[model samples]
Target chain A: MKHTLAVLVENRYGVLSRVASLFARRGYNIDSLAVGVTEDPTISRMTIVVRGDDLVLEQVTKQLNKLIDVIRVTDLGSEDTVERELALIKVNADVNNRSEIMQIADIFRAKIIDVASKSMVIEVTGDENKIRAIEQLLKPFGIKEMARTGKIALRRGPKSV
Target chain B: MKNINVYEKYDQQSDRMTGRTEKMTGARAIIECLYREGVDTIFGYPGGQVLPIYDALYDSKIRHVLVRHEQSAAHAADGYARATGKVGVCLATSGPGATNLVTGIATANMDSIPIVALTGQVPLSMIGNDAFQEANITGITLPITKHNYLLQDANDIPRVMKEAFHIASTGRPGPVLIDIPKDLTTELIDFHYPETVKLRSYNPTYEGNIQQIKKAAEEILRSYKPVIYAGGGVISANASEYLRALAEKVQAPVTTTLTGMGAFPVDHPLFLGMLGMHGTKYANYSIQESDLIIAVGARFDDRVTGKIRSFATNAKIIHIDVDPAEISKNVRVDIPIVGNARKVLEDLLKYVDKAPTDDWLQRIAHWKRSYPMHYIGGKDNIKPQYIIEQIHEACKDAIIVTEVGQHQMWAAQYFRFSEPRTFISSGGLGTMGFGFPASIGVKVARPDKVVFDISGDGSFQMSSQELATVVQENIPVIIAIFNNGYLGMVRQWQELFFDKRYSYTCIRNSVDFVKLAEAYGALGLRVTQPSEVRPAIEQAIASGRPTLIDFWVECEENVSPMVPAGAAINEILDLERKA
Candidate 1:
C-alpha cells in the first residue's frame, strides 16, 4: 500500500538529513519525497510517499515524530488531498512527430515550455497517474531527458499541519 | 576590576529581572550547564581540539577522569549512567578521538543507556576542508545518537547543552552527541542555560490509554496461565517494585531478558532466571506453555522470541512499553499500552485482582526442578560457573559488570541480582572490552559499593589499558578474567553448528593478565583451582586496589540450556542432550 504523509518540520540545517537518515536506517522504503518551505518560513512541509502496511505506516509516523525537528505528521492517505507533481520532458521532436506530441500535451493540458531545432521540452503537472499516462504516449518519441519534482500534497479541507 | 564588578552587578540585576543570562565563553558555559544539570563526574581524554574546554575545566568543580582511550570514556559514562540512573557524560576531541567513541556510542544506543557525549570539532571554516583532527562527527553519529547537534555559533552552546542533556535522559533514553567547533569554545557570548526544554515533537507519552489499561487488567484477571516477560525498560523506568507487586498479586511467574536481570528480585519464588538464547530451561518452558504473556518494558528481541511465528503460540500478549514504535516492532500484541512502564503498571494495578494460576505455578515449578542450571566440574578444577557462584557468595551486594562473551552469559546466569542497577552489561551491542572501564565508572558512581568486572580474557584485553585509569585515580575495582584460551561463545557455536572448524577463536598463551595488572601497579592474582577462586576474590576485595584475577578454567565449557539460532525457545539443548 502506498501512503502519503504530510510532515511539518523546523526549517533548519540538517533537518532533511535527519528525516532521510531515519528512513534509511529503519529500512523504510520512500517512494518519493518533496520538501519546501511552508507559509511560515521557519517551518518546512515534506510530502513523503511511502510503501507499507498499516503497521509500517504507524511506525513511520511514530519514528518521524520522534525526531526533534519534526513538528507534526499527518497521513494524507485517508483524507481528500490535492497532490501535484511537475515533470520536464525533453522529447526528440522533428517535423513528423512534433504535431502528435503537441496534441498529446494539449489533451493533458501540458505546455511546451522549451523548443529546440530537433527537440521540444514539454512541461507537465498532474497527479501521478496522469503524468505516467503522458509519459507513455511520449515514450516512442524518445525522451532525451526528464526531471521530476516528486509529489507535493495538501489536505482539501481548511485544517492544516 | 571595579568596573567589571559593577558590570557584573548590573548584569545580574537585568538577568534576575529578565532571565539567567551570563557573559562567558562557550567552554565555560558548557561547564556551567553541567553544573546546573548536577553532573559531578565526567570521563574523557583531552586532545588538541578540546584544549579550550580543558582549560575551562581548570576552574570548574566537576571531577574529570582521564581515560587511556576514548572508547573507555564513553563506556565509563555508560556504566556511570546505568549504575546511577543519571545521564552520564563523556567527551572527546575531533577526528580519531571522536571516531573512537563510535563503538561505545553504539553500545549505549543499542541498550538505551542515557549518556551525553561531547566532541570537539575543527573550526567552522576548516570543517569541510578536512583540516587536521577534523571529522564530521555529527554526521557519523546521526544514526547511533538519539539526537545530535553541530554548533555553528558560540551563542547556541547553553541551549544546545541543555537540549542535549534533556534529550539523552528522557523517555527511552539513549546517547546524544553535541559536536562543537574548536573556535566556538573560545568565543564569548551571553550564556543562559534554558530552565526547560520546549521540543514540540519530542514529548513522550507518559500515561497509557485508560481503555488499553482496562483491557490489559481484565486479561490479567482472567488469565490462568499468565507469565510476566520483563526487559531493560523495567529497570530504565525504575518499575521493579511495581512489577514485583503485580506479579505477586497475579501469582504469575516472571522471566526476564538478560538486561532485565535485577529488575525483578531473582530470589523471588515467581522469578525465573534470565530468558533468551542461553536463558534457563524453565523460563523458556513457561513462555512456551503460557496462555497469557504480559510483556513489560521489553521488546520481544529475536533472542527472546526465537522463531517469531512459533513464539507464545498459545498466548494472548499484553505489551506495555514507553516507546510506541517498539510495541509491535518485533511481535504483535493483543493489547499494546504505550506509556511509561511504571505509570502503566500503576494504573493497571487499580483494576486487577488475584489470578487463578495454581496449576500454572505447579507446572512451572516442575520445569524449574527438572531443568536447573548446572555445570559438571570436580572440586580440583575451577568451572567458570562455580567461579561466578563464588563471586556471588563473596560479594552478595556488589554491582556486577561484564564484558561480552561466554563469561558474560555465565555471570548473567549464575549471579542472583535482587536489586536494580546491580548488574550492568552491554546487552544490546554486546561490545567486548566494555566491562573493566565501565566498572571504573560504576565505582566512581557508587564509591561505597563493591564493584566487580566479570570479563573474559579476550574481552578484558580490549580495554585493559584502562587499568591505568583505575590505578591513577585510585578507583578500586575487581576484574575477574575468565581465561578459557578461546572466544568461548563463538567456539561453542562452531562446535555445535559449524563442524568445529574453529576459525580464529583461539588466543592461547596471550599476554599474562596477572603481569599486566602488576605492571599497572595494581594487585594481580592467578587462580587455576576451584579452591583458589574464593581466596583470590577475598584478597582482591581486601587489598582495596584495582585488581585483576585471571582464572584458568576449562577451555571447552559451553553455556547450556541453549536454543540454537532461529529455533523455537522451547527447543533448547540441555547438558544431558547435545545437538
Candidate 2:
C-alpha cells in the first residue's frame, strides 16, 4: 500500500538530509517527496509518498516522529484529504494536432502554458489519476519533455493537519 | 516551562547569572559552558582543526584524557555515560578525525547512550570549498545522531552547547553532535550561556496513557504464563528496582536482552537469564509458550524475535518504552505504553496484584533443569567457559565490559551481574574494539569499583593501542583476552552453516599481547592452564596498573544452544554438552 505522510519539521539546516538519510539507512524507499515552507516560516511541510505494508508505514511514521527537528507527522492516507500533482508536458504538435491537443487540454481544464513552432507545453494540475490521464492523451502527440511535482496533499476539512 | 524545569535541575549552571556579559573566544565559551554543565572531564584526540579548543583547555581546570583514536574517544565517552548516568562528551578534529568517530557514534545511537560529540570543521568560508581537513560531519552523522548542528555564528555557542547537553541527556537519551568550524573557535563573542531550552516541538511524553495502562493491567491480570522481557532502557531509566518489583508482584519470569544484562539480578529465582538468539534455552522456551509478555523498555529486535510471526505466538504483549516508535516496529503488540520505563513500571506496579503461576513456574523449571548452559571441562587446555566462571567467582560485583564476539556471549552466560550498570558491552552495534577503551571510561567513572574487559584475541587487537592511554592516564583496568586463535563467532557460524569453510576467520596470534602491554608500561600476564586463571586475575587487580591477561583457550569451541538464523527462538539447535 502507498501511504502519504504530512510531516512538519523545524526550518533548520541539514534537516532534509537527516530525513533522506534516515530513509536510505533504514532501506525504506521514498516514492515521492515534496517539501516547502509551511504557513509558519519557521517550519517546513514535507509531503512524502512511500509504499510499504501497514507495519512498515507505521514504523516510518514513528521514526519520523522521533527526529527532534520534526514537529509532527500525520498519515494523510487515513484522513479525508485532497491530493494533487502538477505536471508540465511538452508535446510535439503541428497545426493539425495543436487544435486537438487544445481541445483535450480544455476538457481536462489544463492550460496551454507555452507554445512554440514545433512543440507546445501543457500545464496540468490535478490528482495523480487526472494527471496520468492527460499525460496518456499527450503521449499520442509525442511528448518531447515532461516534468512532475510529486503529490502534495491537504485535509478535506478546515481542521489543521 | 518544561525546558526551564529540566535545566533548573542542573541549577549550578543557572545561578551564575551575573547581569554582566564578558567577552571571550568561542573556544573559551565552549569550555565555560561545559564547566557550568558540571562536566569535569572529557575524552578526545587533538588535531590542527581542534587546536583552538585544546589551547583553551590548557589553562582550564577541565581534565581531558587524550585517546589514541577518535573512535575510542566516543566509546570512552559512552562508557563514562553508562557508568555514571551522566552525558558523556567526546571531541575530535575535522575530516578523518570526524569520520573515525562515526562507528562509535552509531554504536551509542543504536543503544541510546547519552553522549555529546564535538568535532572541528574547516573555516565557515571554506566549508563547501572542501579545504584542508574539511568534512561535512554534521551531514555525515545526521542519521546516527539524535540531533546535530553546524556552528554558524560564535554567539550561538552557549545556546548550542546547552542544547546539545540537554538533548543528549533527555528523553530516551542518545548521542548528539555539534560541528564547530576552526574560525568559530577563534572568533570572540560576549558569552552568556542560555539558562533554558525552549524548543516547543521537542517535548517528550513521560506518562503512559491511562487507557493503555488499564488495558495492559487487564492482560497482566488474566495471564496464566507471564514473563517480563526487559532491555537496556530499564537501566537507562534507572528503573531496575521497579522492574524487579513488578516481576515479583506478578510472579513472572524475567528475561533480559544483552544490554539489559544487569537490569534484573541474575541470581534471582524468578530470573530466566537472557532471551533471544544467543539466549538461554529455558527463557526462549518460556517466551515461545507464554500467555502474556510484559516487554519493558525492549524493542523486539530481529535477534530477540526470530521468525517474528512465530515469536511468542500464544502471548499477549504489553510493550513499555520511552520512544513510542519502538513499539510494534519489529513485532506487533497487544498493548503499547509510551513513557519513561521507571514511571511506567511504577504505574504498572499499582495494578500488579499477586497472581498464582505455579504451573508456568514448574514448566520453566523443568526446561531449566533439562537444558542448562554447560561446557565440557578438559584437563588438556583451558576452556573459555571455565575462565568466565572463575571470573564470576572471583569478582562477582566488579564492573564487567566485553568486546563483541564469542567471548561476549560466553561472558553473558557464565557471569552473574546482580546490579544495574555492571555489564556494559556493545549490544546494538556489536563493535569489536569497544571493551578495552570503554573499560578506561568505566574505571574513570567508578573509581571505587574494579573494571575488567573480557575480550577476544580478534576483537582486542582492534583497539589495543588504548593501552598507551590507560597507562598514561594511570587508569588501571584489567583486560582478559580469550585467545582462541580465530574470529570465534564467525567461525562458529561457518562451522555450523558453511561446512567449516573458515576462510578469513582463522587469525594468527602474531601479536604478543603480553609484550604489547609491557611496552606500554602496563602489567602483562599469560595463563595457559586452568589453575593459573584466578591467580593471574588476582595479581592484575593487585598491581593497580593497566594489566592485560592473555589466556590461551581451546580453539574451535562454538557457543551452543544456538538458534539458526531466521528460525523461531523456540526451535533452538542444541549440541551435546556434559551437564
Candidate 3:
C-alpha cells in the first residue's frame, strides 16, 4: 500500500541529509519527495509518499519522529485533509478543438494561463486523481507538454500541516 | 545557570564511601567519567604517555580489549557502532599509536558511524616541541572527526568526555575525539560531568521544505521516464518505505549505490545492486540511461560515477542528503531536496500518483539480461564461489566480517546478505587487521547473531592474538581463512602488473593454525579436499566454539573483475585463467 505523509521540520544544514541518511540506512524507499517553506521561513514541510507493508510504514514514521528537527509527522490518508496538486499542461489547440478544450477546463474549474496560436496551456489544481482525470480529458487534443507538482496535503479545520 | 554535577546520584551518596587516598589526575578522571557513564568495554591498546590511562584503567571497572594495532580499535568501534546504534569507544596512546588510529577514524568519518576515540598527547607545553612520543593527534584527526577537543585544561576532562559522547551519538553521527595532555592527567580538577552541551557551531537539522516537497511531487508527476537512485541515505534516513511508495506510485525503477546494498531488499524488481566500481553492468547502465535520477542518501563517489561529467547526461538529478557539503560537492543536481530523506519523501508521497510503467520495466529487464554480474569460477573441484555459497548457507545471515585481501573480494562477490550492518567488512579502509576485532565488535553489539571472521592467511595473522579475546569472552565466531599461503592480492599484483619475481610474498611456514586454535582453546579444522568444505563449515557452526577452517585453496588463485586502484570504474582486469 502507498501512504503519503506530511512532515514539518526545522530548516537547517545537514538536516535533510540526516533524514535521507536515516531512510537509506534503514532501507526505506521514497517514491517522490518535495520540500519547501511553510507559513514560517525557519520551518519547512515535507510530503513523502512511500509504499510498504503496514508494519514497515509504522516503523518508518516512528523512527522519523526521533530526529531532532522533525516537529510533526502525519499520515494524511486517515485525516480530513485538503490535498492539492498543480499541473501546467500544454496541448495543441485549433479553432475546431478550442471550444471543446475550454469546455472540459470549465468543468474542472481549471484556468487557461497561456495560449499561443497553435497551443494553449491549462493550469489545474486538485487532488492527484482529479489532476489525472483533467489531464486525460485534454490528451485527445494532442498534448504538447505537461508539468505537475506531485501532491501536497494540509489537514482541514482547526489543525494545520 | 553554570551548574555542574559530579557522579550525582539522585538518591544519596555518602561522600566518604570511597575516600581517595591516592590522588586523581586528568587521566584518572577520564577513566572515572567513562566508568560513571556505564561504559563496559573499550577496544584499545596502551603505549608511552597513555600508560597513565592503562594504569588507572586497572583500578576501573571498564574492561579494555587490547588490539595488536591501533587501527583495528577504530574499525572495531565502527563495527560495534553499526551493529548497535550507540557510540563506540576506542583509546590509543601518543605518537605512533595516535598516527595508527588515523585510518580507522577516517573510515568512521567516511561511513558516518559514531565512534569516540581517546588519544594521549605528550604534554601541553611540549605540544609544539615535538618531544619524544609527541604528535599533533588532534590536528591530524580534525578533518575526519565531527568535532574534537584538545583538553589542555584539566578541568575540562569530565565535560569533554560527556560532550564527545553526546556529539558522536547525535545528529548526522560520526567519530569524535578528546586528546588529553600527559601532564594534565597529573593535574587536579574538581570532577563534575556536564549534562548538556552548548555549541553555537554545531546542531543538525531534520525537517523538510514544504515547497520543495511540492516541487518534487510536481516533477514526479510530470516526468515520463523517472528512476529513483537510492543510496545509503535511505538506510541512514530510515526512509526505505517512503522511497518505495514514491517509486511504486510513479512506476519508477530503483537502483542503489554500493553503500546502498540493503536499503531496499535485493530481490525487489526495483533493486539494481551496488552501482559502482565492479558494480553490476545493468545497474551502472541504468543510472546512465535514467531520465530523472532521484539520488537519496548517497554521495556520487568517484567509484560510482565513471566519468563525473558524463554521468546521467540526460537525467535531471534529485540530490537528497543531510550533509550540506555533499550537496554540490559532486554532481550537478536539478532538484536539491535538503532534509531528512524520510521527511522529504513523506511530503512528496502526498502528491505522487500510483501508476505502472510498462515500457520502462520492459526496457530495464532487457538491460538486466544483457549485462549480469558474471563469475567464471567453474564447476571444478573446489571452486571459490561454491565455498562462499556453503559458508553463507552454514551461517545464515551471520555477522560476516572480512580482512582486506583477495578473499575479501571473493566474499563480497559471493556472500548474499539481506540487510545493512550484516556485512561488516572494512569497505572504505580495507584494513588488514579489521576482520578479527570487527567480528568480535559485531558479536558484542549483536549478541544474538552469529558472527564470522573471513580472513586470508596474510590478513588473519595481523591480529591473530585476539583469538585470546574470543576464548576469554567465549565468542564462537567462525574464522574461515582462505589460506593461499602467500600475500595473495599482492602476489596477483606481481603476476599481472609486475614481472612474477615473487619477493616477500610466499608464506613458506607460518605457525600451525590448527595448533594455534587449539592453543587458544578453539576448535580447528583443516579442509583439504573440495567435498570437505561444507561439512567443515557445518561442524564449525555447530561446535559452539570459535573455529578456524584453514582452507588450503589453490596457491595461485586470483580475484577476478579487479578495478585498478585509483583508476576509472569501468577499467577492470578480467583475468581468471591460471597461467
Candidate 4:
C-alpha cells in the first residue's frame, strides 16, 4: 500500500537530506517526494509517497517525528483528501498525428504547452490516475519525454496538516 | 570625561539589571557554554583545527583529560555519562580526529548514552575545498547521532551548545555532535547561554496515556504467569525502584537485557539473570512460559528475541518505551505505552494490583535451580567465569565495565549487579574497544567507587594505548585482561558450527600486557593459576594506582547456554547438551 504523508519541517538547510537519508537508512523507499514552503515561511511542507503496510507506515511516521527539525506528520491515506500531480509530456508530432494528440489532450483538459517541428509538449494537471490515463492515450502518438511532479495532497475540508 | 564616566556607570548598571552578554572568541564561548552547563571535565585530544579551543581552555577551569586516541575520548565521555547519568563531553580536531570518534559515537548512540561530542572543523571557506585536516563531521554523524549542528556562525555558539546538551541528555538520550569551524572558534561574539530549549519537533511524551496504563494494569492483574522484562531504559529513566516495585507487586519474576543488568537487584529471589543469547537458561525459560510480559524500556533486539516469530508466541506483551518508534519496530505488541519508563511505571504502579502467580513463581524457581549458570573448573588453568566470580567476591559494589567479546558475556553472567549503572558495556553496537576508556570515564565520574574494566586479550589491545592516559591522570581503574590466545567468541562459534577450522580468529599473544602496563608506569600483574585471581585483585585495589592484570584463562572456554542464531530462545544448547 502507498501512503501519502504530509510532513511539516523547519525550513532550514540539510533538513531535506536528514529526512531523505532517514528513509534510505531505514530501508524504506520513497516513491515520490515533493518539498515546498508551506503557509508559514519558516516551515516547509513535504508531500511524500511511500509504499508500506500499516506497521511500516506507523514506524515511518514515528521515526520522521523523531527528527528535531520535523514538526508534524499526517498520513492522508485514510483521510478525505484531494491529491494532484502535474505532468508534462513531450510527444512526437506530425501533420497527421498532431490533431489526434490535441484531441486526446482536450478530453483530459490538458494544454499543449510547447511545439517544435518534430515534437509537441502537452501539459496536464490532475490526480495520478488522470495523468496515467492521458499518458496511455498519447502513447500511440509517441511520447518523446515526460516529467512528473509526483503527488501532492491536502485534506478535503478546512482542516490542515 | 566626567559625562563619559557617568554614562559608562549607567551602562554597567543596565547590564547588571538584564542578563549581560560577554564578548569572547568562539573558542572561549564554547568553554563558557560548558561552564554554564555545569561541566567540570572533558575528555579530548588537541590538534590543528582545535588549537584555538585548547588555547581558550588554558584560561578556563575545566579539566581536560588528554587521551592518546580520539576514539578513547568519546568512549571516556560515554563512560562518564553512563556512570553519572549526566551528559558526557568529548572534543577532537577535524578529519581523522573526528572520524576516530565515529565508532565511539555509534556505540553510545546504540545504547542510548548521553554524550556531547565537539569536533573542530576546517574554516568555512576551506570546508568543501578539502583543506588540511578538514572533514564534514556533522554530515558523517547524521544517522548515528540523535541530532547534530554545523556551527556556521560564531554567534550561534551559545544557543547551539545549549541545544546540544538539551538534546543529548533528554528523552531517549543519545550522542549529539557539534562541529565548530576553525575561523568560528577565533571569531569574537557576544555570548549568553540560553536557559531553556524549546525544540518544536522534539518534545518527548513523558506521561503514558491513562487508559493505556489502566489496560496494562488490568492485564497484569489478570495474568497468572507474568514476567517483568527490563532493559537499559530502566536505568536511563532512573526507574529501577519503580520497576522493582511493580515486579514485586505483580509477583512476577524479573529478567533484564545485558544492559539492564543492574536495573533490579540481581540477588532478589524473583530476579532471573539476563535473557536472550548467552542469557541464563532459566531467564529464557521464564520468558517463554510467561503468560504476560510487561516489557519495560526494552527493545526486542534480535539477540534478545531469537527467532522473532517464535518469541513469546503465547504471551501478551505490554511494551513501554520512551521512543514510540521502538514500540513495534521488531515485534508487535498487545498494548503499547509511549512514555518515559520512570513516569509510566510510576503511573502504572498506582493502577496495578497484586497478581496471583504463586504457581508460576514455583515453576520459575524450579527452572532456576535446574539450569543455573555453570562452568567446569580446572585444577591449574584459570577459567574466565571463575575470574569474574573472584572479582565479584572482591568488589561487590564496584562498577564493572567491559570490552566486547566472550569476556563481556562471562562478566554479564557471573557478576552480580545490585544497583543501576553498575554494569556498563556496549550492548547494542558491541564495539570491541569500549571498556578500558569507558572505565576511565566511569572512575572520573565516581571517584569514590572502585572501577574495573573487564577486558579480553583481543579487545584490550584495541585501546591499550589508553594506559598512558590512565597512568598520567592517576585514575586507578583495574583492567582484568582475560588472556585467551584466540578471539574466544568467534573461536567458539567456529568450534561449534564451522568444523573448527580456526581462520584468523587465533590472535596469539603478540604483545605482553604486563610489560605494557609497567611501561606506562602502572602496576602489571600476571596470573596463570586459578588461585592467584583474588589476591591480584586485592593487590590492585590496595595499590591505589592504575593496574592491569593478565589472567591466562583456558583458551577454549566458551560462553554457554547458547541459543544458536535464528533459533527460539527456549531452544538453547547448554554445555551438557553440547557434550
Candidate 5:
C-alpha cells in the first residue's frame, strides 16, 4: 500500500537524509517526496509518498516519532484530507493541437503557464487522480518536458495537519 | 527576514514544580541531580564547550575520572550499568568526541544495557551553522539510542535530566543521549524538577496484553518439542525466576544468545550452552529442530539465526520482546507478544497447564550426548582457550566483560558462566574497544564483585586509554589480554577466505604488556606456559588494584562450530583443533 504522510519537521540540514536513511535501513521505499516551508518559518512540512503495508507504515511512523526533528506524521490516505500536486507539462503542441489541449486544460481548470510556437506549458494542481487524468490527456500531444511537485496535504475541518 | 524570540522554556510564575524557586544554571542543576541520584564516580573527558560543566564539577563533591578518550567514558558507563542496575553516566565534549562515543553507545544499545551519555553541543544560535566542534550528536545517536534530549534552555534541565535517567533505566533498558548547548549550561534559571513526565506519546505497556499472553501459553502447552531461546532481556527484565518456571514446567532446554549467557545457570540441566557461532553443537541443533521455539526477549539476530529463510523453518515461533521494532523486523513471528519479557512470561505461565514433557527432555539429552560443545587443544602448550577456562574457574562468581574479535568469542565459548550478568560482551555492535571501560563500569557498579576484562591485543588497543581512568579511580579490574599479536577474527578470515594476505591485522609495534600495566600503576603478568595460566590469574586477581595479564598464545587458532556468513544455523563448520 502507498501511504502519503505529510510531516512537519524542524529545518535541520540532515533531517531529510535521516528520514531517507531510516526508510532505507528499514527496507522501505519512498515513491515521491516534496519539502516546502509552512507559515511557521522554523517548521518545514514534507509530503512523502512511501510504499509499505499498513503495519510497516505504523512501525515507520513510530520510528520517525523517535527522530527529534520530525514533529508529526499524518497519513492522508486514511483521512479526509485536501491533497494537491503541481505539475508543469511542456507539451509538443503545434498551433493546431494547442487549441485542443487548452480546451482540455480549461475543463480541468488547469492554467496555461507558458506558450511557444512548438510547445505549451500547462500548469495543473489537483489530487493524484486528477493530476494523472490531466497528464493522460496531454500524453497524446507528445510531452516534451515535465516537472512535478509531489502531493501536499492538509486535513479537513478545524484541525492542524 | 524574521523576528527571533528569545528561546526559553516557559518560566512559569509558580515554577514547573510548585512552591520552590532556587536560581541555578542547567549545568549546576544537572550536577545537583546526579549527586542526589548517588553518582559518586563519573567517567568523562573535558572539552571547549563542556568546560562550564567541568567547572561546576570542580565545585561539586563528585569525583570525575578523566579518560584519555571520550569513547572510553561511554563504555565505562555501559560496564558500570551492567555491573550495577543503576544508570551509568558518561560525559563528552561536542562534535568528534560525541561521534567517537557512537561505538560505545551502539554497543550498549545492542546489549540492552542502560547508560546515560552526555554530550556538549555548540551554542543554540550556532546549532545548524556547523560551528567549530559542532556536530549533530543527538541526530547521529537518534537511531541507536532509546531516547535523546537537546537542552536549548536552562529551565528544562532538571526535568529533562531526571527523565533521561528514568527513561534509560525503564522498560527494555537502553542508552540515552543528552546533548546540552554550552550556553544553556551557563545560563542561570530557577531550578524546578517536575515529579512526573507528561509524555502523551510514550505509553509503554509494561504488564503486557492478557490475550496475547494467553496465546503464548496455549502455544507453549501444545508443543511437544519445545526449546526456550533466551537473550539479554531475561537479565534486563530480571526474569530469572520466570525463565526457570517456564523451563521447569515444560522440561524444555534453554539456550541463550551470546549476551544472554549468564541469564540461566550454565550448570542447570535445562540450560544448554550459549547458542549461535561457537555455541554448543546440540544447543544449535535442538533449537533448529525443535517443534516450538519460545524466543523470549531474543531478537533473531543474523548471527544467532544464521540465514533467516531457514531459521527454525519447521517450527512455530513465538517471540516476546519489549521493543516493538523487534517484531517482524527480521524473521516473521507466528505469535508476537509485545511487552516486558518478565511480565509477559509471568502472565503466560499463569495460563500454562502443568504438563511435563519427558519426550523433549530425552531428545535434548540424546543430542547433547551425540554432539557436545567441546574442543581439546590436546597440546600441553599454553593457549588462549585454556587461559579463559582457567580464569573462569578462578572467578566463578566474578563478572567477566570482553572486547570484540576472537578473544571475545573464546571467552564466550570457554567461560562456563553459571551466574546471571556474570558475562558481559558487546554482542551486537561488536565494538573492539569495549572491555576495559566496561570493566570499569562493572567494577564501579559492584565494588565487592570481582571483574575481569578478557581482551584481545588488537581490540584492547582501541580503548586501552581507559587504563588512566582505572588507575585514577583506584578500582580493581584484571584485564587478561590474549596476546595473539593479530586481529584474530580478521586473521582467521584472511587465512581461510582471502588466501592469507594479511594487511592491518598485525600489531606492528607490540608493547610489553607488563611494562604497559606498570606504567599505569598496576600489576602485570606475562604467561607463556600452560602452568602459568592459573598462577597468573590468581596473582592478578589477588593484587587488589588494576592488573593486566598478557598470555602469549597461538594466533592461528579459529573459532569452531561457526555458521559461516549467510549460511543456515544447522550448517555449522567445526574447524580442526590443534592436537
Candidate 6:
C-alpha cells in the first residue's frame, strides 16, 4: 500500500537530512518527498509518499514522531487530501507536430512555459496520475529533460493535518 | 524566537544572575550554561580543536576526568547517567576523537540513556575542506542520536545548550550531540542562559490514556497465565515500585530483559531471572506458556524474541513505553499505551481486579525446579560460574558492570540484583571494552557503593589502558577478569556449530594482567585456585585502590540453556544435553 504523510518539523538546516537518514537506516522505501516552508517561518512541512504494508507504514510514522525536530506527523492516506505535483518537461518539437502538442497540453490544462526553435518546455501541475499521463504522452516526442517536485498534500476540511 | 521570550522572564527573576546580559566568549558561555544546568563532573580528553573549551574549564569549578581514549569518556559518561539517572556529559575533539565516541553513543542510544556529548569541530571555513582533525560528527551521529546541532554562530550557544539538555533528558532519553567549531568557542557574545525551552513539537506524552489503562486492566483480569515482561524503560522511569505493585496485585510472574535486571528484585517469589537469549530457563518458559504478556519499558530486541513468530505464541501483548515507536516495532502489540511507564502503571493499577493465578504459579515453580541453571564442578580447574557466584555471595549489594561475552552473561545470570541501578552493562550495543571504564563511572557517581567490573580476558585488554586514568585520578574500582585465554563466546559457537574449528580462537598470547595492573601502580592479583577468589575480592575491596583480579578460569565452558541463532526460545539446548 502507498501512504502519504504530512510531517511538520523545525526549519533547521539538517532536519531534512535527519528524516532522510532515518528512512535509510530503517530500510523504508520513500517514493517521493516535497518540502517547503509552512506559515510559521521557523517550521517546515514535508509531504512524503511511502510504499509499505500497514505495519511498516505505522512504524515509519511512529519513528518520524520520535525525531526531536518533528512536531507533527499525520497520515494523509486515510484523509481526503488535495495532492499535487509539478513537472517541467522539455520535449522535441518541430514545426509539423507543434500544434498537436500544444492542443494536448491545453486539454490537460497545462501551459507552454518555454520554447526554442526545435523544442518546447511544458509546465503541468496536478495529482500524480495526471503528471504520469502527461509524461507518458510526451515520451513519444523524445523528452529532452524532465524535473518533478514530487507530491505535496493538504487535507480537505477545516481540520488541519 | 522562543528563547528571546524566555530570557525576558529570566531577566526579571534574576536570583542567580548579576545582570540581564553580559558579554562572554562562547567557551565561557558553554561552561556557564553547564554551571546553571547543575553539571559538576565531565569526562573528556582534550585536543587542538577543543583547546578553547578546555582552557575555559581551567577557571571553572567543574571537575573533568581525563580518559585515555575518547571511547572511555563516552562509556564512563553513559555509566554515570545510568547509575545516577542524570544526563551524563562527555567532551571530545574533532575527527578521531568524535568518531571514537560513536560506539558508546550508539550503545547509550540503543538502551535509551540520557547523555549530552560535546565534540569540537574545525572552523566554519574548514568544515568541508577536510582540514586537520575535521569530521562531520553531526552527520555521522544523526542515526544514533536523539538530536544533534552544529553551531553556526556564537549567539546560538545558550539556546542550543538548553535544547540539547532538554531534548536529551526528556522523551525517551537518548544521547544528543552538539558540534562546536573552534572559532565559535572563541567568538564573543552576550551570555544569558535560556530559562525554559518551549518547543511546540517536542512535547512528550507523560500519562497514558485512561481508556487504554482500563482496557489493559480488564485484559489482565481475564488472563489465567499472565506474565510481566519488563525492560529498561521501567528503570528509566523509576517505575519499579509501580511495576512491583501491579505484579503483586495480579500475582503474575515477572521476567526482565538484561537491561531491566535490577528494576525488579531477583529474589522475589514471582521474579523469573533475566529473559531472552541468555535468560533463565524458567523465564523463557513462562513467556512461551503465558496467555497474557504485559511488556513494560522494553523493546523486543531479537535477542529477546528468539523466533519472533513463535515467541509467546499464546500471549496477547500489552506494551507500555514512553516512546510510541518501540511499542510494536518488533512484536505485534494488542494494547499499546504511549506514556511514561511509572505514570501508565499507576493509572493501570486503578482499574485492576485481582484474579487468582495459583495454578499458573505452581506450573512456573515446577519449571524453575526442573530447569535450574547449573554447571559441573571440576576438582582442580576453577569454574567461571563459581567465581561469579562467590562474588555474589561476598558483594551482593555491590554495583556490578560487565563487558560483552560469556562473562557478561554469567554475571547477569549469577549475580542477582535486588535494587535498581545496581547492575549496569552494555545491554543493547554489546560493546566489549565497556565494563572497566564504566565501573569507574559508577564509582564516581556513588562513592559510597562498591563497584566491580566482571570482564573477560579479550574484553579487558580492549580498554585496559583506562587503568592509567583510574590510578591517576584515584578511582577505586575493582575489575575481576575471567582469563580463559580466548574470546570464549565466539569459541563456544565455533565449538558447537562450526565443527570445532578453533580458527584464531586460541589466543595464547601472554600479557600478564597482574603485571599490567602493577605497571599502572595499582594492586593486582592472579588467582589460580578457587579458594583464592573470595580472599582476593576481599583484599581488593579493603585495599581501597584500583585493583584487578585475574581468575584463571577453565576453557571450553559454554553458557548453557542456549537457544542457537534463529531457533525458537522453547527449543533451548540445556547443559545436560550437548548440541
RMSD, each candidate, Å?
3.3, 4.2, 18.4, 4.2, 6.0, 4.3
Q: How would you encode candidate 6's per-residue C-alpha lDDT over B180-298 as one tens digit per residue? A: 99999999898888889978878899989988989999899999999999999999999999999999999999999999989989899999998888788889999999999999999
What lDDT would each prediction earn against the true structure?
0.91, 0.90, 0.76, 0.92, 0.82, 0.90
Give each candidate's fraction of reference contacts reproduced. 0.79, 0.96, 0.00, 0.75, 0.04, 1.00
Candidate 5 TM-score to native: 0.88
Off by over 4 Å in 4: A94-96, B1-18, B576-579
Worst 10 residues of 2 chain A by lDDT: A12-21
- List model 3 lDDT by residue over B2-109, tens digit each: 112422431123233233323467777788777655677788978887877887776555667666678778877888877766778999988998888898898888
lDDT of 1 by residue, A60-133 (tens): 99899888899999999999889999999999999888899999999999999998889999999999999999
TM-score of each: 0.96, 0.95, 0.69, 0.96, 0.88, 0.96
Tens digit of lDDT per residue, candidate 3, span A1-161?
A: 87889988877544666567667867989875778888888888888877787666776785676554577778876788787888899999978888899999999999999878889999999978898898888887888889888678778899765
Give the DockQ (2 decimals) of all models: 0.80, 0.84, 0.01, 0.83, 0.25, 0.88
Give the range where candidate 1 chain A is weakest over 10 consecutive residues by summed lDDT: A152-161
Model 1 chain B: weakest 10-residue lDDT segment is: B1-10
Where does model 1 sit among the CAPRI classes? medium
> Model 2, residue B308: what's the lDDT?
90
Model 1: interface root-mean-square deviation in Å: 1.0
Whose DockQ is higher: candidate 1's or candidate 6's?
6
Alpha carbon lDDT at A81, candidate 1: 85
DockQ of 1: 0.80
lDDT of 3 at B315: 80
Candidate 6 residue lDDT tens string, A96-156: 8999899889989999999888999999999989999989998998999999997999989
Q: In model 5, how large is the Cα lDDT of residue A20?
A: 83
Using DockQ as the measure, the top candidate is: 6
Chain B TM, per prediction? 0.96, 0.96, 0.86, 0.96, 0.93, 0.96
Better of 4 and 6 by lDDT: 4
